[model samples]
Every structure is written in structure tokens, then in C-alpha cells.
Target: MSEKSSDTSGRPESSPESGDGAEAAPGSTPAAVSGAARVSPGRANAAATKPARASTAPVPPQDTGPDVPKVPAYLQTQPRPDVWLGKGPQPPGLLSRLRTPSPPAIGPATLWSVFATALLSALLLGDGLGPNLLIVAVPAALGAFFAARSAGRVLRPWTAVWAVGGMALLAVPALREAGWPVFLAVVSALALGSLALHGSRSWPGVLLGSLGLFPSVAGGVRWGWRGVRDRAGDSRGRVRTVVRSAAVAAVLLIVFGTLFASADAAFADLLGRLTPDVSVGDSPWRLFLFVLGAAGALAAAYSAAAPVRWDGITVRPGKARNRAEWAVPLIVLDLLFAAFIALQLVVLLGGYDKVREETGLLPAEYARQGFWQLLWATVLTLLVIALALRWAPRGGPRDRTLVRSVLGTLCVLTLVVVASALRRMDLYVDAFGLTRLRISVAAVELWLGVVLVLIIAAGVLGARMLPRAIAASAAIGVLAFGLLSPDGLIAEQNVARYDRDKRIDIEYLESLSADAVPALDTLPEPLRSCALEHFRRDLARQDTPWYASSWGEVRARDILERTPVQNHGSDCYGLGQEADERGGDEEEHSYDPY
Candidate 1:
């Protein structure tokens, strides 16, 4: 025991009670003090808990005093509430937005919103708000929506209708005046909303946004007008076009105006007979129509030679050759067209002389004979087209500039011819009410002009140069021609020949009957002949040839519809009657039948 105790004493002390009894003695003293205090009720419990911990181990030096304050429960953080905590997993990507299998189909109500918007635009543009508003607005607006939604997609049929209609509306003057930038902004916003709400499937929504320009301006500016001046093409081609156009206009003005103006003098000298004035300028209407016709004819011919596609969004030529070689067919077509034009002049001049010699015709008779003139002219045009396919620029894989030059020359010449024809036809009586024929001629002419320029610019250079320059130039030319031409001046003239003729007939029938022949004789040979031919036709009351009937044969000759008709009774009679009735009440006038 003594040995063991000595060995243990030599080992490390485990506590203060053993040779380390210093720690245990202090702890035990505290416990004894606490036990004594515990004899006094509540304080005894606190002392008991303190004694147990102190007896087990000494306090660490790092510990702070027991007077530390407790933390408040309100300062603690709580767990977050999850919105989707219990929900099933969602689909990734865009599919997540969809709640059902099928997205909502655009219905009538939504479509109506588009239509209403478009119609409102048209009304502001002054495009005669009417029952056919759907026809006018649906295609443009829908097309635009689809174009924007699809970015660059083709649209379904219904979507197509809306896009096209919407585009038409945006083109109106009221919207265009708002500036294209703002217009486009609105379109983008509207398009986005439409896509979000209606979910269009059309690919052409991308294209319809492009249609914004179509409605505002017939030829949307591919590049601004300034672009037209900066870009260059075949330098020779440009200079040649400008020079040729100017020359043709000058020559035509001189030839047609001079020869026709001098027709009465020549008649008196050669046939020993006096005649009336034949000068084009004296009859502003005639001059105007002739120029318009010339312009129209040229435009139409060019259009036929180089057809436009996709409603002017783009131009793709009908021919299947390289553009360099395309000039071959175009040139041949031009030459043939030129020959046909020459033949027409001969026929017009020759036929005119014979009609003048037989002066018992009425205006109807003259018009009837004019049908033959038109027929022959059409045939000549067809023949020219045929010849082009056979001989000129046969496109047999040749590297040539002559074909291009020829085609370009023809294009220029066509403008000249159309202008000349319009001047000759006397389309407008005054500036406001367009004669049916003249209006039709003008419409066809203007549209063709637009198409020709597009064909040349797009088809010719589509694969080579960017179309921006050519498109802009063509657009400017078209706008200038439309707004500044004599046609516009006459468009403002508020008189109608039909109105005048009826007034003259009612007011001075006796005077007209007595002097009609002398007056007819005084007219230049062509006019006299035209008058005589009509007079005879009316007297004979012959049935108009069926083929001679206008495009809408039995349909009412609504000039607004742009239909051609043969022997369609002139609307002038009723119009004249109404005018006579209105004026007769103001001033007493004796009605006499000649």
C-alpha cells in the first residue's frame, strides 16, 4: 500500500483533491456554501445546479461574468414561404408559359379589332369609308401583324388577309403624316400585342411589316431618295436613260403637236378645203389624255416585257436567263414594240383621214371606229411580243450589252409613247371628274409605270447589285410623274366633257344643228373624221360588236371600277339631264331636239 501510494503520488495529479485538490477544494467550497444557502427555500435550487457544474470542472478563463443579458426572441430569422412549394414541376423554356395543349385561336372579336383599326386609318387617309371596308383593310393589317409576329414567315390565308389590310390602312395619309418612325413603333407594339393575345401562325407577319410602305406610298422606299443619287449602275445606262427620255419627250411634243396643229392648214392647201383647229394644246383635255396614253402605253409594254411579282415586294423577271442576258429578250421586245408603234401611227393617221371625209357620224360613231384603232393597236403590240421571242436577244447564251441597251431604250421610249398617247386622248374634261376611258387609261398607265421601274431595278440587278438604289430612283420618278404631270393639272380641272356636251346639246340644240356640220368641217381632219364616224354610227344605230364590248360587257360602266366596255351608253345623258334640270330652274331655257 505504501509503495503503491508512493507510485501514484509520483504520477500526474487528476484533480485538486488528490495533489491537484486545489481545483476540487475551491469547487467543493462553493458547493458547501450553496448547500448552506439552499437550506433557505428558492436560493437552494439555484445553488444546487451551480454546484453540480462547478464540481465537474473548473471555469474557463475565457468565460465572461454570469450577469450577461438574454437575447430577445423577435430578432431571430424565420423560414421563407414558397409560392410553388407544393406544385408539380414546371416545363422548361417557353413551354412553361402555356397552361393548355392548344393556344387560343384568333376569333372574330380579335379580328374585328384589327379591321376597325385599319378602317379608321383609311378614313383618316380619306380613302372613302364604305361597306367594303373589310376588303380594303383586312389584308393589309393582317399581313402586317403576321409579318411582325413571324419575323420572316409566310402567313396562313386568314392571316394573310389581315396583314394585307392592315398594311393598306397604315399607308393612308393621316398615318404617313405621323412619320414612318412613329408609325412603325405603333405597328411593332400592336403586332406584339396581337401575337401575345391572338397567337398568329402566319409566316408573312415578317413581310407584312414591310407592307407599311406599300399603303403609305405605292413604292415603299427601299432606300431613301438620297440613296438614289449616291449609287451608280452602268454609268452608260443611266446617262443614256436620262438623255433618251428627254429627247423622246421633246421629239414627241414637237412631232405630235406640230403636225396635228398644222393639220387644218395642210388640209386647206392640199385638199382645197378649210378645217377647224387640230392643235393639241388648244384642247387641253386632248393634250392631257394623249400624254397620259403615251405614258400608259409605255408603262404597260414595259410591264409586259418584264413582269413584276409578289406585289412589288420583290421583282423576279419572267425570263429564265442571267440578268446580263435578260437584256436580250427585253431588247428584242423593244424593237418589235417600236415597229408596232410605228404601224399604229400609220393606221391612226390613215384611218383618221378616211373618217373625216365621211362626216355624217356622231361621237358614238367616232368612238365605235376608235375601237378598231384600239384593236389594231393591241394586235400590233402582240405581234411585237411574238417577234421578240423569235429574233431579238434570243437569250442563246451570249455575253452582250446591246441587249441591255436595247431594253433600256425601249423602257425610255415606252414612257414617251405613254405621255404622247395621254396628250392625244384628251382624258380629262376639266381637272376633277375624270372621263371613264381616260381614268382607266391613266390607272393602267400609272400602275404599269410602277411595275416597269420595279422590273428594271429589281429583276435586272437583283442578283448583282442591291436593289436599294434602283428602287428609290424608280419610286421618285413615279411620284414625280404622278403628282407633277399635266395629268395632275387636268385632274384638278373640275369639268366633264359629257357634262359639257349635254349642256351644249340642251342649251343650243338648234344652233348646234345648224352649225354642227360647218363646225365639224372646221375641225382638223382627224377630229372631223372622228366626229363624222360617230354621227354615222348613231344614225345607223348599229349594234356594237360583242368583242368590242368592254371588259365588263353587261356591267354598268363604272369608271371607278376601271372596266372597259363597248357601246355602253354614256353616263353623260343622265348626268346632263340632271345638270339641265338644276340649271333650268335658275334660268329659262328652251329644249330642242335636233
Candidate 2:
């Protein structure tokens, strides 16, 4: 048998010398073979059974060099051949790439602004939270705003609105000395302002952007460092000259000032008074505050200028369920809510007597028992509405109508639950004088009612603006809460309760900050002396700087100064004796203002 040839198509070809009494097909192979031809058994079998077509193109010579393995089909599409083969340097990781600084360096003007803000923070914040907080916060916010503007970033109308709101919240510490309100107000202001700066639109985006502030602060530091490094090379000569001049000037001033002070005693006194007394121990703290302020401001400006497009991050909705599947459970829930509301209506009208007869508890006690559960129910209802909306079918008009009807009814029922919760809190407060916890919970319940209303409005109109509206409402609620002064309100309520019932928690009043002083000062003789004593001593001892003096503290001090306590002693109200008699059985309640 003659050797068989193969074609580029990998098919075996018949040879004319093959003595099988079969002639070769016309043009079955090329006229001149390019290489030693060999065919696998499989190809030979196929070629023997099937005829081949004539070749149209000349065959190229095969390589006789050392064989190189071909890349697998999957590997051929790889972006980096060396990487795929585990050869050469591997690329940096996702984190490394993220850490690497990108362009739009901090400009000199912005840097100077950051420096001034930092310096102001170091000087003013050292005293504590007060007008100093407002002073530092305003400039920092303005610096960020202006820096962003200078960098050609657009400032939306809402940006200015949020900025003003944040500044107003920051002023809470300046106006009120209550620790809880000030802390809450300041924290809310920061989080909301961060969202505003980044222009977050959706609820998820707002949450993520608020959290992104920390990383942004860190990135801002790195960004500022890079800007400084890039500019250092260009300004090396000028920096060196400036440093040398500063050092020489410092030495000359020290030497001549000492000589002049020695020559004149009055000059020495004046110099001593003028010079700042900064201890080495305090320098690090001051430096920390400065860096913190600078980092925060720079982060805000950086975020405002080149905001991460958090709103652009699309969250895939859950697969839409059939209208019946989505709406059925919600409808059932609404029915349950409606039944509960109907029962609540009975109680609201006059059935409290029946409840008391069955439970052997007063109306207030009954209200108190279910208040927390009702609050949680309202919260969970809102959550359910959110989830239902997420998974509701996006079919034709009918599906949408179903969604609106079911969810809107549920929301309306939830508003009644919120009202019940607030009414419960009111009854409890009326029965036993208002405490911070009672008032705070009442405020939260009221805000929940407001949210339900907003949700209803969204369902009526469109849900596109609902998230922003909800967020704005929350900000407004917090602002109103802080501005109203929860501590002051608590004191006023207790005082009024005392006027009505001739009973008050003097011990609790004593624990309140200066925010309650004005209210507490209105009490009668010994009670006034008892309630005002703590603040009187506190304000007298607090030698705060002018910048750090809060309006509450200032007013308290003025009031106490003008009307000094007639009776002052640790046992002014026999509170210790009362506590001893009670065996210290008072329940200590800790509340989270958030």
C-alpha cells in the first residue's frame, strides 16, 4: 500500500498506488506534497468511506522546528498571557488599585482653607462643645463648599439647604447644654451633611454614603499628601528659603524679647500675658484635633467635588411575584391591622373600663403594657410595606393599582398604630410625670406617624421622591427635637405635673444639665434651691472660654448669679435621707436617645 496524504482540513486522501482496485479521486490532493504525510486511524477510516473535495489553495510548509504546544481555547482569550501562564509579575490587587491616588490634586487655596479650618479647630475645640463647635463647624462646612465650587463642582440648591441644616444642628451644642441632645444632634448633622455633600439620592445610597465618610476622610488625607508631594518638588527652593527665614526670625525674636523683658518689668508682664501657655503634653492633643478637622473638611470637599456615584449603583429588585402572590399576604396583614385598629377604637372611645375590668390594670397601665409592642408593630409594618413594594409585580395598570390599594391601606392602618403608641405614651406620662425616656419615645412615635403620611403621599403621587422626602423629614424631626430641647421639656413637664399633683422628682431634676435650669428655677423655695443647686455649683466652677460658653450655661450662670441660692448644702433637700429611707430601691433607667 502507498502512503496516504492528508489535506489542511485534516481529512485523509487516497493514493493512486493503493492496490484496492479503486482509482484516486480527481484533484484529491495537491500536486506536490509539502511534508511527509501521515493520517490518524480515525481520519483514514473516514477518508476510505467518504470522498474528499478538490483543494482550492496551495498547502503551506509545516514547521520542522521544536514543537510548541498551542494555547487552550479558554486561555487564548485571557487578557494577560503571562499572568495566565503564571509568568512575570502579577498585577496589583483590587485593594491596591483602590488605594492608589487618582488625579485632581488639592489646590493651594483649598489647602490654605483646610489649614485655617484646622487651626481654628485646634484653638476653639480645646475648650469643649459650645459656640466653639458652631464656630468651627460653620467655617469647615463653608470651606468644603467653597473648595468644591472652586474645583468646578456644581452645588445643588439642596446642598446649601443641607449645609444650613447641619450648621444649625451644630449650633445645638451652643444653645443647649444637654449631653444627649447635643450628642444626637451633632451626630445626625454629620451623617446627614455627609449624604448631602455626596448628593446621595436613594435610601441605600444615603446609608452607604454616610458610612463612606470614614474612608473618604482617609482617602482625603492620602490625596492631600500626594498633592503636597507633587508640589514639593516645584517649590523646594522657596520652602527651604521660607523655613530658614522662619527659624532665624524665631531665634532673633526669642533673644531680643528676653532682653527687652529683662529691661522692663511691665514689658515682661505684658509678654507673659500675650504668650500662649502650651505644654508639651497638650501639643499632641491639639495636633490631633487639628488633623481631625483638616481631614474632615478635606474629605467633605473631596467628596463634593468628585462624589462616588453611589446613586448610580443599581440594586436588582427581587423577581416580581404574581399580583395575588404579592398582594395576598399584605392584604391579610392589612385585615389583621384593621381588626386591631377596630379594637383600639373601642378602647379609644370608652372601653377602657372593660379592659380594666378584665386585666385589673388602670387605663394608663394597660396603655403602658402595649405601647412598646405597638411601636414595634408600626416599625415592622413600615418594613413590610418596603419589602412588598420591592417585590410587587410591575405588570400593567391593574397590578400597580393592586399594590397601591393594599400597601396604602396597610400604611393607613400603621398610622393608627403609631397614634395608639403615642397615645399610650401620653397616658403613661400623664399618670406618672414625664421622663426623658417617655418624651423621647413619644417623639419617635410622632415621627413614625409623619413617615406613614409621607408614604401615603408617595403612594398617591409617585414613589420616586419618597426616599429623599423621608430622609429630609427625619432630618427636620431631629432638628426640631434638638431645638425644642428635650431636657428642658422634661423639666417643664415634671414641674407642671408637680404643680398639679404636688409631687416631683427633685433628684431627677438635680441630675439635669443647664438646659433645664431655666425651667427648674421656677420652682418654689426649697425645691428651687434643690433643683438649681447642682447647676449653680456646676456653672460657678465651669470657667469655660468665651468661645466654649453655651447659651444654656450662660443663662444658667446669669440666673444663679442674680439670684444666689439662700440655702446650700449637700443635704439641702434631705435627698440622702429619702434615698436611705427608700433603701435605694429606685429603678435606674438607661435610655438611648437615638
lDDT against the true structure, per candidate, is 0.36, 0.74
Instruction: Give candidate 2's TM-score.
Output: 0.76
Worst 10 residues of 1 by lDDT: 506-515
Residue 190 of model 2 has an lDDT of: 89
Model 2 Cα RMSD, Å? 9.8
Which candidate number maximizes TM-score? 2
Tens digits of per-residue lDDT for model 1, 1-594: 677456444432233233222223454564453333112223333333343333456523422358767778897677766867755575554222321122122223323333344433332222122123333334434433432343233445533443333333333212111122223333533343232222223223233423322222211122112223333332557657766998999899667756765877764364322222244454555445334322322222121112222222332334444554545556566786677567545334534344345444332344344433443443354355334333444444353355445545665555545543443343222211333244445544554455445445543665232222333333333333322322222222322333343232322211121113323333333333333334334324523222222222112122212322233244323433554455442222223221
Q: Give lDDT for model 1.
A: 0.36
Q: Which stretches of candidate 2 lie over 4 Å from their true place?
A: 1-103, 236-277, 349-360, 568-594
* Backbone clash pairs in model 1 (N, Cα, C under 3 Å; residues 3+ apart or in different chains), count: 94
